[model samples]
Target chain A: MRAPGGVGRRWAPVLAVLAVLQCFTLLLLGLGQSAHAGDRPRGCGQPLPVAGSAGFANAQAARRTNVNTYGAAAIVEQATASQAYSGDLASRFRSGEGHFRLTFNDTFGAARLLTLCDDRDPGDQQTVMGVDDRDRWLKKDRLYEQPLDLYATNVYVSGGAQAIGGFYSASVTQSVLGYRGAMVAGQVINLYPAFFAPAVGNWQRGDGVASYAVDWVAGGYLDLGAVAARVGTAGANGLFVTVDERAIGLFGTLSRGVGEAQADPLAYLRAGLQGFSLRRFGAPRLSEAIGQSSLFFRDMPVGVDPSGDAELSRLRTLHLDQRAIAQQVEAALSYRVGQQSGLYDVHLGWHTPGFYGERSDLKGSVEAEDEGFGIRVGMIDVAPRYSLGVQGGRYFSARAQLRGEAITGMILFNDPEQLALFPFATNALSLRLVVDLAAGG
Target chain B: MSRSPHRPQRPARPGRLSSRSLSWLTLAAGLGCTQEVAPDRFCQEAATAIAGRTEACTGDLDLADARYAAFYEAYTCVDVPVESMGEDTASPIAPQDRLHCAFAIRNLPCSLVEAYGDDIEQYMTASPICDTLVQPKGGAR
Candidate 1:
């Protein structure tokens, strides 16, 4: 007789490939539609929407220059026009134009109002304010203030199921970046599945029963001595463990333009519903279950008090009982300088407490890299962890390249109590070899 | 600049080091070669050093009048059982070493403190004299 579940096992890889192909086809279709729609001009009297308060701040900064030439009357007229434009934009955003319209409806509107009155463009004020003609000044002013106006939309789908030896993993991501204004905003959907099987002796029978069932069936035989030997061999050869973990995450990002003069530096905000899962399976031990669950799934309610329940409070402190989906937000200000051969960038940011379950630290990162070699260093404050990553690459052909990367972290300062519960070892290192098949290798 | 007991003296002819050497030295220091000190003494010394540095740096009359009350309150030593400080049974901070680290931070030079500025807490833990506060069980250090 055929082995049990053989048909399903044989079809798994084919099904996975089909799914990936379907996703890519949909992504390509979306891209074509978005590209066609992007070029269409806004309705008459509708000022193009800008990203968040940074856009308004740029407008205000430009207005200070207008005061000298156009005078108070022009400012008053502009204000009236701006209010009407904002109201219309807000209504359209609520009506849902893009994928993020439903997700970030309230957030986008709220963020647009977060105008920092003190934010000023530290560029050549004279040139910004200098406008010779009063007749076409408003149109010129708008053009001058905006750093980026090229509206382009793109959708990318990458990664699929892969099985190498005993290791099995599948990850797929669809990212959509579109132009709403001068800044680019988008949403990403990621599906990740974790599955692994050891190459050791068969742990399961043809009928899907564990091998231990045979011992149990034979007159309740208990082999304690043999159990230890089996475990030792399993550990040495890689344990007979299967983790059925799957997570789906949604992410949204909003950014401000770097300004006409400041082309390299950009300030952005990002928020995500990072892996909100309701059910999980296949973890045998409590620690393993907790660790796996914590990695991709977070289900704790945000901005609520759990003080009444002592157990809940304890779990939150240990980051254990997370079963309600919550939002994690990050804001970063970054600057980058690029050359023909290489580029350097630095960023400073803050993450909400318990952000993505663990990375709640105020962080700063610096990366300086070229085509052949690169290095990145990131420092975070909570555990005071310092992540160092080094990458080296070699080009095989015009369309093929190979790269190797090594990443490690050092916990300079840590709370011993916290470390005991969530073991983040400083000695852990990750090595990866990536092969790139692209046009520009 | 006038020197104090809390501040380490710089050599009259300070040896010049290349940028690469300086980077290596900084990395080595960050790796942490620490010395043990009594907690109470460390607290006292740290508080004194901070108070003295604040008085020297501040030009604000109101802050001077307050005599940096906040700094003193934060750095002041409190009596607590060593076990209460950490929950890790495998490796915990030795009470004496923790105290010593505290003292060393309190005695850091004004220049060094100013250089670190907002990142003083991070520097303190990563500092050579304070890094070994957390030691394996039975105070192996």
Candidate 2:
């Protein structure tokens, strides 16, 4: 039976093909021919405007975030080690029999699954890593700074933006595994170090005495430590992630007590949380962009022919990467609500110790009691999309971000999966003046 | 196993034991020998005819395109030879392969390429796979 107009025409062929293929096995797409086999893909998104202090040194090479992030650390101990190579690396990479290729649709995993049916909140790519950082390091490459040395001169470029924001705005963006939850949640409340705050002097509605510096409203929070660890270890070809074993805690408390501490019923509640705060070694630059070429060592087995001419089957190349790590934790707190004179966003979070994603870290945030109450006017956490693609949770970013949009900024822990759609993660504290329109409102 | 003296096994004696082993084997070998004597016998001719035609059509002498070759080596593939009444395939080149080959040899002298440059190109596209034998060869287009 045919339908009316163009609809029927389009579907008729498809229906016929499906019906024929279903009945006759010979009409398969591949006809049983195996797919090409070689290497798994390396994935990295756009630059995240999350790290205000970080230079976009590697934004051009998003995949290389891990490599450059580790810098001299990757060779801290490997220096002076005897170098040895047996054969051409590529030549040794013979395709295994029966190996096949597999392709993943955009936004595949938990996040996509959750948002698959939802019309709003499309996921997208964010957080770029590339620039001056080449994926190489001597046994001891010097740090990057003024009075450049032999290591810094040949190691990194002077271009690229810094990472500042995170994932929470991954709107319809797809990954190999359908936006699996990498870093989906966090909570932060601080006025300073504000990478994405509105311009200070553009006060359209307030006086200097009681000014509104910034306002944020986030609803999803994914685990940054888990995400940093997972995507960081994607391949030995990029950066390396190391979790500290020390039982360090991230303790933060924000309290405003008045003249009489005991009699002040208006004493702001003090919230403190302690644990390990994770850290990550941003990967090295990936992909050839701008004016750049990746020099790779070709390894092909030497083949002999009857005519004395050598034949090389195929050429294979490997891009090596080196990295390093450090210990640090990021924590923030404020009054849950605005006081008579300022803003307050009180919160409790559990974090593990050190650099990027920590191995052991459990963090959660308790939003202000009246955040979603119908009576409240500034509450916007309705039907939020989490990094896990879960509904009704605050979106959070869990990695150092390098947002490329105007008003650029960096976020320490933006969920790649969630921010794959939303630009802000780590906490539901949605802020104003974000380049991503989705997060601001 | 013991055999009945009265009803001797069909393949046990009185026949070419070298040619036949058992009832089933005997039948298969019998057919084989029959074809050797009369090679054109339908069943005997079918297998070689089917195989030769496929190889000839493939044009490739080796595993150059292993991806496509795997299809032929597949367990489920079927084979059928061109019947005497079947269209003459002695042309060596399939109609389509001919056009592609012709275009591939464009500009070469005394070849289909020089004779019908535009026409060959229109039919075979600008380039043809290196193996086709269209003319003026030298791995034309």
Candidate 3:
């Protein structure tokens, strides 16, 4: 049955009341220029691993039997994307990389290197903005170096069903400029419970990650990890020092077989869930430094407190707990088969706020607008993704495999009115190819 | 019938190389061991230096510059809509909400474009002065 068309009519009064309350809270919070939260980059647009559950098992087995061993081919992958975005800059990206692993002393392991370079141009971004002259914006024939992954991993301990490891990886990305208006004269009115959508820009980041995992005999596993990152933007102030901010977070994942672990461990009926929460500290100092950077051309415009009074100082030292940044949850189902096996698995998963968040400033424009916001926004709405894959190879003869995946129901927020709205299928579609090269060949 | 295996006989040889030959051998071994460890380190240093290079604007900010003047004319005393500002990507306001510009500049300074030369494209896209002003395809409004 269709719902009434006048739903907004009833909510109009409630929203009016909220608007009043929002004004009052804006005074108490003394909000000013806010920064983007969350340690994970949004919308890298890389393809998920093929045949979700099965791929996990295959990777785990590879880690145990063939990974990090001296003189072994270990693992190699070649990937490309139709389009990828870092902050505001978007580009067509391609990557070719491999892992040269060395295993020693039985359980101790090390992946000598994990490296990839992401290349994208601001030209497309310029075009989307309507600039026809490439030379006007691009001073030289050059490409921006976007780091995909560049780090090494060490497995300090390993055994039959569990392992622990830590990694030190450093990479850079862009964070775009986000503009807001002021509520009071000469003061930027930033309110608590501030709404944010991802924009295209650069945010350079480097961090250390430590992870632990355990696998059960029933074709299931649990994984946990922590991240401490130094994230910042370019120093526009000419001093050439990065305006740095610190963030820390905890993340975990769990997967179990829905039916049963097949006689062949490679084949399984399984499902998995994953989530993360990240908090940024020292915001007050970072924002001030950024304002001084060449990026802003000036200090953070004056800020107002939650009590509706001018309080420029509040912007610098906001509490860590007060800033509950981003929390993400994801679930996926995947199936795989041995050349000899058949129909071994199935997966279904969902993530909230789906894939893309709305760019609130681009409210009316279609390119960045999300008409689904009014319905339901943020991580509560699961953007569903799925994959199916197959594998064949022996240790020494080398292994080769291929798979395909589809992600549906993701809400790309661009419009202000679409808040809390459910995403309908639109231009959101992607296809991916994965190749694994193993040892022996 | 059995056939005998062929074996070549050699005359007696010297027990050691001549002095001149030995010297040459030692030189060759020394050259082989020279791995050029420092060159690898130097390459890394050079690459990082280049990566860190950025362009800077020359000359002083001229208030009369058209771009700078335009910024003042449009944004000064105007309520600009701020959906998400700064690094905090959290609870944002709805569209149609407009905030006033605190800085009283007449135009967006050309220095901004020059100072952030690498990201000029982003500025062009977002800046009112350089915006293409194309409408959204669907009736999103």
Best by lDDT: 1
lDDT tens digits by residue: candidate 2, A1-441: 334565455335434533442332222111111110001001111111111000111111111211222222222111101011112211111111110111001110111100001111123112211323221111111111110000010010011111111111000111111111221210112212122322222111211111122211111112232221101211112222222112232221111222434332111111122222222122222210111111122222111111122121211222211111122122232211111112212112222221122222222111001101010111112122111112333333232322221121222222222222221112211111112111111
Taking the candidates in order, what DockQ does each have?
A: 0.01, 0.00, 0.01
Q: Which is better, 2 or 3, measured by lDDT? A: 2
lDDT of 1 by residue, A43-111 (tens): 111122222112222222122211111111111111111111122232332232111100000001101
User: Which 10 residues in a row give candidate 2 chain A its minimum summed lDDT?
Assistant: A145-154
Q: Candidate 2: global Cα-lDDT?
A: 0.19
In TM-score terms, candidate 2 sits at 0.14
Q: Any idea how many clashes model 1 has? A: 5
In CAPRI terms, where does candidate 3 land? Answer: incorrect
Ranking by TM-score: 1, 3, 2
Worst 10 residues of 1 chain B by lDDT: B28-37
Interface RMSD of each: 28.7, 34.0, 31.8
Instruction: Please give me the total number of clashing residue pairs in predicted model 3.
Output: 82
Question: What is candidate 1's DockQ?
Answer: 0.01
- Give the TM-score (vs. native) of candidate 3: 0.15
lDDT of 3 by residue, A1-441 (tens): 326745454345434533543463243212210100011111111112211121222222223221111100111000000111122111111111111111111110111111111112212243223544333222211111111111111111111211121111111111111111111211111111011101212121211111111111111111111221111111111101111111221211111112333121121111111111111233543432221111111111111111121111100111111110121222221112221122211211222221222111211111111111112222212221111011111111111111111101121221111110101111111111111111111
